[model samples]
Target: MEGKLRLAKKNLNISLKQKPASFQTSSPELTEMLGMKLAKWIKKHRVGCVVFLGPFGSGKTTMIRGVIKGLTGLNNITSPSFTIVNQYAKGKMNVYHFDFYRIKNATELESFGFSEYIDSGLLLIEWPEVAMEKIPPKSLKVTMEFLGLKRRKITIGFI
Candidate 1:
């Protein structure tokens, strides 16, 4: 069982390296539009996890709000900074949004039933550096960087 599992994991990793998709958004509307496109891709691909990396005020939360709107048609969304996690339901699909900025260690993740959330629904993680080692191998990684006051360069790839 272990050998088969390892093989399957290896194959999945190899498959993810096919190509990466990237885009640049100069305004909040453009960022949200990109998020909506990502939402469609996520649903079509049945993506399980996504890790968001960006500096503070880089619009990570805004992108997430767009994703929620695309997935569940929910317009109101907020960052889970203090709360750590937020769960949303849209018919049969469940989205589990997590913020690890406050986490001190991997043990903290385990303490809060992080593993359970991974298997329960689609995961969108912000500030994943706190527990980078614990993130699943198949997760999609999104990196955002500010170009100017409102422009952002967003890159999406598997890592």
Candidate 2:
């Protein structure tokens, strides 16, 4: 059943309803700008969750910093590596940033009541592979890949 669900998800063209977008960034500044653009889309759509897929130093955090700054106008964005999750408030909306890099399994996520946050606020998860099964099916997925030097290719779509 899970395999079928995965296959069906892969075949679904979410872009048909809402076009997917991609961006290339050669510096942290550009990456953050791209993230800010995505933030606007998320707010317009009232997106509840976003999953970020990328290796370390691929500028995932940098992009998230842009999103937070754009939405909340707070410049103190940082990775939640040690804390696991960080929450920020923007008016009535709350942004929950989660890093699953150190998580070993889904059970670890459940131990901290992860689902509650997903149900309540805008969620941005980094290294989502560690808890793929827990991610909401409707969540947007962003993939970042290193091209060369400081350049990164970011693809945004729904799955």
Best candidate (score: lDDT): 2
Q: Candidate 1, residues 1-159: lDDT per residue as tens digits? A: 432333223321213747766667767777776677678778778888889999998888888887878899987688899999998998997998899999888888889878777678888999989767778777888889999998788888886
The lDDT per prediction is 0.79, 0.81
For model 1, the superposed segments whose C-alpha errors exceed 4 Å read 1-17
Q: Looking at model 1, which ten-residue stretch has the lowest summed lDDT?
A: 6-15
**Model 2 agreement with the true structure over 104-142: per-residue lDDT tens digits:** 887888887787776788899998887777787778998
Which stretches in model 2 have alpha-carbon errors above 4 Å? 1-19
What TM-score would every model get versus the actual structure? 0.86, 0.87
Error of 2 at 78 (Å): 0.9
lDDT for 105 in candidate 2 is 82
Model 1: which residue pairs collide? none
